[model samples]
Target: MLPRPSRLTLPSIARWARLNGSSSRAASGGVTLLPTQEPTPEANATLTEEEFSSMIIHGRSIYPPLYHPRTHSVPVAQLQFRAYQHQFLDLYMHFVGHAAAALGIPISRPVYLPTQRSLWTVPRGPFVHKKSQENFERKVHKRAIKAWDADPEVVDRWVRYITRHAMPGVGLRVTQWKRAPLGIGQQMVDSAVGQTRLGSGAVKVKALAEKIVQQELLVEENADTATR
Candidate 1:
């Protein structure tokens, strides 16, 4: 049997119906739109973490996602979601956090960034009242979720899964850091010349302060002995 569609899918299905000029009836070829199923309050309230996770995997959960405890604190990736509505954005991010946790990937508490507002004024007026113009404003809410101490492959899978089941009206952006090579001096050291990357410029620098200090002290001692 086919899986039941979630509440989030209702809006899009209705939109398609309208676009196909089918309002009180099914679309062309008897393509009937399935009614969205919303869980009752009792069921919603009694949802366990496992139940919620299953529903969320199908994009059908009503309650907010439960966050898992962080296992590792090292930040590996960050996810940011932007949407005009804060409720859906927050819900979607929490969903991602919960899924990552299921994969044993630690996640940080979401960071609530400032809402960005944009206002536009046009020459046209409301209802052809050209004498007076109106101003319209839009606010986009942003939230950031970070993955901590997670392997790159795990993070990638998490992202891929979330992308496949993306929530409507939400925009997702991901930022990930490249892993550094293992062991000491493996990242930027040249074994032959003993040089390392210094700053962002082309200037070459060596960290030999201790050796230089010892050489200067020995030179001073030699000078004193020669004077003696």
Candidate 2:
């Protein structure tokens, strides 16, 4: 049987209202259709027409785009996308993976994070009856993609392109890590000493900070090694 269509988005909800009689209980779903066209249906006896157009599907499908292997192994940046509807989030994420592949960017595997859920309870009726309480829940879906060994400029361009063509109801967050040269703190410490006779306490503090930074770099290297 073919996969069921998603009705989480506003347009899909609108389509559902149009297809199913609005007088039914499902009429609560709004009606909003997009300009894009759906694929033509196939001839199959096992699958009914209605199920092909609409039905309940658990663990929706996620089609990831291709990635071109590159020599760059360090993770330069990451992208986090979220939406109330998983369908929209996954669709846009798929598009981003493909766009990056087309540009020859080396991206890591797509990461699916846990869904965040919020709940509320209130009295169903005017009377404050404990037995007549109402409950409501809202869920936010999240997904992330990380690019490795790609040029910072290329990553910036990809981010801009995605922002310009972002879909409705989805939010994007970007984070980047800058690589620093080794032993760069020595130059700063020397310059400070030349400018003024710094006390031993200040120099000791600077050395301690530099040691912490070096330890962090080592931890990152260990983590990268483990992933490989």
Candidate 3:
């Protein structure tokens, strides 16, 4: 007779059953088993100091340094953003400031203007129920951003960027003060005359005016000759 197989304990049988079930589950593509060992110090030490120091998270460098340059000026233009919701307006302003800083623009602290409030009262019921009415109020929030000693082209690009990605329910307005050199009027006139084209009809009208003036002058000359 063959020797009886060694009897397995209940705990051993249960453990064996669990191992078989896990293996089957893994083979069936239901789950995967991963190693639980942590990275060893030797593996970590393989990385150079610079390589480890330059690591980035979410596309931003870790512990980036900031550079501040001394300046002595204010911006020539002011960008103002307004919205009925103060929270959104403030959030967008912070975003703008961040963008400006990234672009190396010297920005000043945001100036907050007085909030504008308007109230309206309307009847809640029929016209006969004049005593029953409801009141509604709205407030407008405004923020002003100033940049100092920034290039106009750069400022324009910044404005375009902000406008293109402007948040919903927010309105943007730009105010620029430009200094004109002497003889600006003459320069403008010269530019208009040089660049503008007169239509055929306009040319004809101008010729007709000159012809009329010439005819009037000739008539006066003929009258004076006749009198002589």
Global lDDT scores for all candidate models: 0.68, 0.71, 0.66
Candidate 3 accuracy as lDDT: 0.66
TM-score of each: 0.52, 0.54, 0.52
Q: Which stretches of candidate 2 lie over 4 Å from their true place?
A: 1-64, 128-130, 194-228
The root-mean-square deviation over C-alpha atoms between each candidate and the true structure, in angstroms, is 13.3, 21.5, 18.4
User: For all candidates, what are the clash counts?
Assistant: 0, 2, 0
Error of 1 at 160 (Å): 1.0
lDDT of 3 by residue, 55-78 (tens): 321222222222224286755678
What lDDT tens digits, residue by residue, belong to model 1 across residues 165-185?
Answer: 999999999999867767656
Clashing pairs in 1: none
Best by TM-score: 2
**Model 1: lDDT of residue 172:** 92
Candidate 2 lDDT, tens digit per residue, 1-228? 244343234234344434554454444454333324442233133343333223332222232344667585888889998899998997888778766865667887679999999999988777556579889999999999888887778888889999999999999999987687898899888888867757556778899899999999999999999999
Off by over 4 Å in 1: 1-60, 125-130, 184-228
- The superposed Cα distance between candidate 1 and the true structure at residue 124, in angstroms, equals 3.2
